[model samples]
Target: MAFDSLGRFGVWRGYTGFSPEEAREYEQLGYGTLWLGGSPPADLPGVESLLAATETITVATSIVNIWVAPAKEVAASFHRIEAGFPGRFLLGIGAGHPEHTGEYRKPYDALVEYLDELDAAGVPAERRAVAALGPRVLKLAADRSAGALPYFVPSAHTAKARTLMGSNALLATENKVVLTDDTNTARTVADPAIQLYLGLTNYVSNLRRFGFTDADLAIPPSDRLFDAVVAHGTPEQVVARLTEHVDAGADHVAVQVLGDDYLPALRTLAPLLAARS
Candidate 1:
């Protein structure tokens, strides 16, 4: 189970600017895994440091968009990274959005074909996962790859996903959290990222699966939508929200700090979480 490979919780913060040594510090600080989400260039050089620095923490691609990262390029990177760091790497690839790239095809078919290429190139299914959010993709993740690494989903979706896939598939769900008491500023910082996802059909479809209406996923994230998926408040409160996800069904709760500066937010929780853990 990927369950044992992960910590009780993981930080899904940015790796956009941090050097690999910095990631090592986060690993030393007791964060089990780092999920790189900003879709950094698909290369092994960037991942090598993160894998080499920490002996235990698993550095994963929260997702590498298939549009930008071809299977051959990813396969080459996989072999290079795995040769050096062994099991410390996990490949997460997904078809991002039809709108973002006008050349998008039948994503499900594309994903399967991509997985086939990875398999042919000797990437083990156990060492890779897909960015999945719906029933078909989730099932595909279970049947083919290691599991699904779903982003921007609520605890309800996690629970439902677990029920659908049972104890077999790895359920790693990312949650956008803020370490603040002020609702307005937090939402203001969060609204941009949230709105960027508003038009993604895959994400919107996933929301609908969880009983959210079209109105719920409009331009700005509604209160019900925000309250359901995003967790805001103190570290303790955020932890409480994470606990709800764990209780519901998630195996790993990857936290994305919902503000401009995530370092302060992570630093605030690091000591307390590390000490208690």
Candidate 2:
């Protein structure tokens, strides 16, 4: 697998927030990949647009939910993108949460079936990844796909994922960043950002494994829980915290900046993260 093609650090955000021109700008800023968050559709034309805009930087879906998007259609889209932009696209797919999906059932089995279809449709195993958090799914990711893309997790979870996946599989974890010095302001910005995930069992269960208690996982989330999951500080401090993920085991850190704009945080972080790379 050419996991090295995706550099050590990348940007993560909603696809709607960026344009083709903005994607080129992120590439120029030294980010190696652009992860489009949210469960995108099977026909990933937006992914194609980002690929067309950037030269070397990779563009990937944070996840294309298996329940909503059929494997055959997704495989067809993968072929379409690969024909025009070969090594620049990575398909990240996942079995979405039960609360969000009306037909959610046996996620592991569904993911296995989806992978089988992708394989039959010729979507190379090395070109795709699974959004996994638990050990069972992480092992499945390593056994079936190129890697695992875990979201709403801390460095502790990243370390666990690496141990579960073994050394060979790629471990790309998302780290939320809020650029600020004040603790109250940082948590204020980050609390609402993760409000949706706190209610989700998958994410809450993962946090529990990391030692977060029921009180910590409350509606507003304990301060310790918030701080641990979201890196909030000055630019240099945020970089330091992000580096902890790489130190723990993450091959690539997909940074999700929590603020009104993404470009400013990306610009501030580009040089610091690039220096480490």
The Cα local distance difference test for each model comes to 0.80, 0.90
TM-score of 1: 0.93
Q: How do the residues 125-241 of candidate 1 rate in per-residue lDDT, one tens digit apiece?
A: 998888888888889988888888988888988888888778977888899887887888778878888888877788888899888987889878788898777788788777778
Residues 21-113, model 2: lDDT tens digits: 988998899998899889888898688788887899998888999999999999999999999999889999999898899999999999999
Q: What is candidate 2's CA lDDT for residue 209?
A: 91
Model 2 regions more than 4 Å off: none
Candidate 1's displacement at residue 126, Å, is 0.3
Task: Tell me each candidate's RMSD, in Å, in order.
Answer: 1.9, 0.9
Q: Give the number of the best model, judged by lDDT.
A: 2
All candidates: TM-score: 0.93, 0.98
Q: What is candidate 2's local distance difference test score?
A: 0.90
